[model samples]
Target: MSTLFGLLRKKMLAPSLASVGFAERGFPVTPSAATVKLEAVPQAVVCGFEWAIEGASLWELERRLELVEPEQRGFAYEGATMGYTILDAMPGGGRNRTRELLEGPGKPHIFLTYIGIGFAMARLPRPLWKNILPELSGVPYHPTMSWLAVDGYGFDRAYFDTRRWVDEQLEPEPYPWAGHPGYFSRAFDQGVGRALWFIHGGDPRAVAEAAGRFPERRRPDLWSGIGLAATFAGGCDRAGLAELRQASGPHHDELALGVVFAVKARTFSSFVPRHTMTAAGILAGLTVEAARALADRTEVAPDFDAPEPPYEVWRDRIRADFSAGDQRRAG
Candidate 1:
């Protein structure tokens, strides 16, 4: 976003985005993953970083990013998938393609579509977000929702790419992956709930059912993702919010606490989106003073460093809090 107009647009939007709780700050360039390094990272992510640093406009960057075929099927693919989705809508529009992906045999890459919506989110504003998200009302908790992690990446990169928000970046480490047997890269799925929040327009009941559809072992993680998204983008009513928590069964508090911490941490960012304020309201249970207090508490946490591996840390923290009893209760 370093182009003259992109810079000007960012400058104009940064303060407003910050006010809404969206982080306009860019991520660092350091490779902090336990297993990877700069050169070893996914080519598109690294190349995207280089492209941004070199002042590629969104249009110019999309040339490579939007292409469906990848340079190489590196360890991580969502980053590149997100790049494609940002340039334009999905094939035959959002709803049709999403439905086909969901109802058809290929369930895995379905998350790719959701994350691709994040790219759309980067280019389009919240008012128009519905354009890319399509209405998947009765879609039953499709597993692609698990790819909500990709959606999170899309949101993170769309709103906070170092190239776009050049003022507050640091060195980044490698993007985290679940290693070896891969197992669908839950490491990458950290923000699945948040993206689900966006995909379902913050419908707590829908989010709950979606999480429930996952398996006994996966519910807590799914709920936590929902909590993150609810805090970041959900605008549920109190009753709906309560239902959201209720739907999570026993892990509701843990989910809310994680999302609260996430929202609180991001509040320190130099930029935010307009919906952030609404999300802050949801995080605070719809009270501004409470939200402020919530923010104040997280502002001083010991491990809250912008340059660290945020998504991974949050996941670890939530899982650490999750107990067998809690899991049973949730079940």
Candidate 2:
């Protein structure tokens, strides 16, 4: 039921499964069970993109998305959100598609859905960025968490153009996303940190090294991103997670903060895989329940009106708790 334009959009925008492989991206990840699993995550995203761009109805998309296993289902929804976001930005495309998805079945996966909006931003013009976020006023973390879209944008850029964003360490010019231009670059670096996980194929040492390569100030955000991806997307085992923790050095609290957020997201979606639980224990030194409690305890109100967005405040509270060694008792 796709229009000709929708078909063409799918053809042009949806990435091939093979393209997401580490080898395709010139990464040095060895062919292993872990690498294969990591690759499948993006492939799932691509599937969602194809389905959404092909004009799948909400019911149809939900059916297709539900077919994905629980652990990876949120990621597929991320891709579908991205596809719908892109469509919504196009000429003659109404903006309600993203709103409908997020307000309905996409609500559970709202965290990832915001990141999907970032993926769409990578493809759209700057002028179109304003219309990207829908009015989800009563949504739990709508405006504040929208920073994940910027994070997602950073992830997309680093993933697709490693030489420029990663190797060259080019800083993106700041834009006033969510009215805080100062924090934009930090959120972007968080996404770059997430990319480092994929770029290094979840090698704990390599990810640590990649993060260290950035300037000292940027390392905290980068480490935070790495923690989120490593825990949520999960390419490494417990020992590897321990190694990542060890390698984090002074940013260990920042890394643990990311783990807490990842746990919150997974728990919010009502699907915490064993790997996430393992990562929480190894990296954050807390059980999943404890991590979720820490996140909830530190969460800022949605209407937190200040120079800093509530998202950063929430992150800061968690980070501060980690620094004080208080997160372990959060549960």
Task: Assess each prediction's global lDDT (C-alpha) against the native.
Answer: 0.42, 0.91
lDDT of 2 by residue, 149-191 (tens): 9999999999999999999999988888988889989999999
Top candidate, metric lDDT: 2
- Ten-residue region with minimum lDDT total, candidate 1: 20-29
Best by TM-score: 2
Off by over 4 Å in 2: 326-331
> How much RMSD separates candidate 2 from the native structure?
2.2
How would you encode candidate 1's per-residue C-alpha lDDT over 178-250 as one tens digit per residue? 1212333343334444444433445667656655655556555556666765554335655666676667677
Off by over 4 Å in 1: 1-184, 270-314, 318-331
Q: Relative to the unseen true structure, what is the C-alpha lDDT of residue 315 in candidate 1, on a scale of 0 to 100? A: 41
